[model samples]
Target: MPTQIVNIKDQLFENIFDHAPNGVAIVGLDFRWVKVNQSLMDLLGYSEEEFYAMTFPDITHKDDVAADMELLGQLLNGAINRYQIEKRYFHKTGKVIWGLLSVSFERSPIDGAPLYFISQIVDITRQKEMIGQMNAITNIANIQNEKLKNFAHIATHDIRTHLGNLGVISGFMEEELEVLKNNENFLMLKEALSQLESTIDNLNEVRKSDFSTEERMTSLNLKDFVDSAIYNINAIARHEQCKLINEVDGTFNVMAVAVYLDSVILNLLTNAIKYSSKERQSYVHLRSLESEDYIILEVHDNGMGIDMEVHQAELFQFKKTFHNRADARGIGLFLTKNHVESMGGKITVESRVDVGTTFRVFLRKA
Candidate 1:
């Protein structure tokens, strides 16, 4: 070749090797590293001398070497002139790096032999990381979706049962009130009517326990909250021959929505009183404990407890009543659990038949 032609060819070769954005490696036909540029050194974390001493096979991950060697055989057999694949390269630090590798053959200008195997490696580590994160998030979402579906089914059943009971009770009250309209005990009848109205209002509030409007949350005093809720349910407690024991002392604050917290406490307390053993009087204890990041408010009752082995799975379900009684509507614990978790809290139950039940409500520390 002429001297000027040789000089232009050398300049073109230098430009391609030095300025390529992707990692470029020139290997001998024997699969030994012949040259490496700055990009290749950066991608593989190898120095120029270190890379030159290693063959292409030496830097490939052990798991990928077999498949890569098979591809190489195919390439050498003239099955393909160029091929692209995602492969892993072992860095000098022994870390695996994902890369989109494109390999092509080049014939020598002097000998017309297969003197060069030119490979370009495009790094794709960040893409792989993002894919992994997306998959993890998808799995978590799937789990939550199943949980929510089960919750909805239970809530619907319990609410329907409660509404049915309320309908029957209201109908009875109407008939009795009509009979007592002209009786000598009119004042007592009127008082009973007022109490029924109040009870109905409270039930309405419980039914509307969708606290989705609250955008903010804060630590609330458990003692005060329960006391206020008990005051509201005092009439029902008295009529049911129930006693509420307040063991919660001081302010045990937890991050929660005010309405939701009130509804949760009220429902659990009423549930205890409602399910009290018919032969014995009902009593409830509202207690609290402070932990590092949560406040646990336990509502314990000496009422009819649960059979955990048979009912644990369905305990938080809507409208699933364990006892086949006219008053067992089953929405109390369902609503309580929903209200608790909606504000980033949790509720769990421990119980034994006839012994009693304890509901542990865990809320974020104030």
Candidate 2:
């Protein structure tokens, strides 16, 4: 009965070892394979007989052999009891396979002499391939972003020079030909030139936010900032027959890049006023709400609201216009969104056609 029980225990151990999920092997002190499980053979694309005839160094990637041998030497010298390393192996079919290899030294029961090694290999080839793919994609995106920055710099410099020259020429013509100043075609040319200049300015603003490397954030009182924005835009609001109201709490503070916050506020306020409905009493209202990590600034307006179903996808895109307004360059919301996101915040909108629009700007809490 004692002998039978011992045999049963050995069978159970063998079953667990042979059916292990990862590759398992027993290697002789001479680095030759003493025994290998089915998983090890499958992992290296070799039969058990072939693996038994070979040594680990024979299948190891040439570049990895030295490092693996050094670790084994440490284990042999009793410097380390066990070791693990990420190494490559050459499959029988000539492909490289990545593996997480864990190994421990075994000793003879009575003599305490070196016996063999127990090794476990977890295949990590798929994970390694996925990491490589992600790194490649990130590199491509960085290259394209750099190219865009360079293009923006060149376009801003060269185009501004040409626009300056046109402005000078237009001023000269206006001064010398008073009769042509009133001509319909000449008036149209002036308007077009003005619009072009405004567009270039908008492009420069967008470029600044998009490529700004260091964004310095400071704590700002939400109400004070909203008041300042309303003060600056008061003339335009009044001219458009739109009332500007500040409903933000006086004590609410937020963390934001100052220039970016200012731009975001001004853009939302101006757009609200600019697109106000003629059929109603137009008003732009500013308020705030608090979340655990963010302070939300809500700018609601009784304006000519957007058809979100039709224009939601392009709402914040460059030069994308939803309404037919002569002054609509479509840069305001785009720049605002860029500014908000650059500061680690986000902007969202809610609107109903001919009823109202509300822009919610989320900022980090101070």
Candidate 3:
């Protein structure tokens, strides 16, 4: 009865080892296969007889052999009891496949003599391929972003020169025809030119605030920045009959580029006041909220809110306007969004037509 029980235990061990899902093998110190399960044979596309005649180095990718040997040497010298690595193996079909190889050794219990190695391999070919694809996409996007920066720089320089010459010519015309200065059409043209110049200046500011890999960020007090924005925009807020309220906490600081942060805050505040509702008491409120990774600054307003259902898609697009106001050049939100994102932040909006709008800017917590 004792002998039968021992046999049953041995059979159970063999069954469990052989039916394991991942490749499993017992290898000698020479790295030669001494025993292998069906999974191991199927993984490397080899038969039991073939595997026995071949050493692990025979199937290992040539480039990976050196690292594999180095780690194996550590294990052999008792420097490590086990090791794991991502390695490539050449299949019988002459193709390379990726595997996560984990190896440890068995030793004689009485004398502590190294016996053989137990290697388990799990296929990671699909995951490696997916990582490669994502890397390629990231590279492409980086290249495109750099190109956009260069284009904006060049365009701003050239357009500014042309506008300067046009401005000079317009001045000459106005002086030569003094009566024309008072004409409504002439005034309109001059106002349009002035607006164009302002638009270009905004674009240049946006270009200047573009983030670069080497640019260092500074820690800024959120409340201080909000206060500065409110001070500068006070005249406009008063002119528009909109109240400005600052609720950002003094304790909260954010990592940001100074010019970029200023532009983002000012734009949101100005927009809120500019679009304030005429039917009710209008106010623009600024506040901040905290998260583990980000400081969310919010600008809320009771304004002539956007019809989000209709303009959501075009909200942040350049030259896309949702309002009929003469000052609505449609680039404020566009520039604001660019500035926020360039600083490794993000912007989102929530609005209801004729009700109110809230703009949230998420910045890295300092």
Expressed as tens digits, the lDDT of each residue in 279-331 for candidate 3 is 99999888899988899999999899999989999999999988898878988
Q: Please estimate how well model 2 matches the true structure, expressed as its whole-model Cα lDDT.
A: 0.88
Candidate with the greatest lDDT versus the true structure: 2
TM-score for predicted model 3 compared with the true structure: 0.60
Candidate 3: lDDT of 289? 96
Q: Can you list the residue pairs that collide in candidate 2?
A: none
- Which residue pairs overlap in candidate 3's backbone? none
Model 2, range 28-96, lDDT digits (tens) per residue?
999999999999889999998899889999999889999999999999999999999999999999999
In order, how many clashes per candidate? 5, 0, 0
**Residue runs of model 3 more than 4 Å from their true location after superposition:** 1-12, 180-195, 210-366
Residue lDDT tens for model 1, 1-366? 899999999999999999888899898878888998899999989999998888888988788888877887788888888888888889888888899888988876887767778899999988988998999999999999778766755765666567667656756766877865466344344444454454445445444555443455766787888877777677778888889888886767777776678778888888888888777877988888877778899999988888999999998899999886897788877888888888887888899999899999998887
Candidate 2 Cα RMSD (Å): 6.4
Best by TM-score: 2
Better model by TM-score, 1 or 3? 3
lDDT values for all models: 0.80, 0.88, 0.87
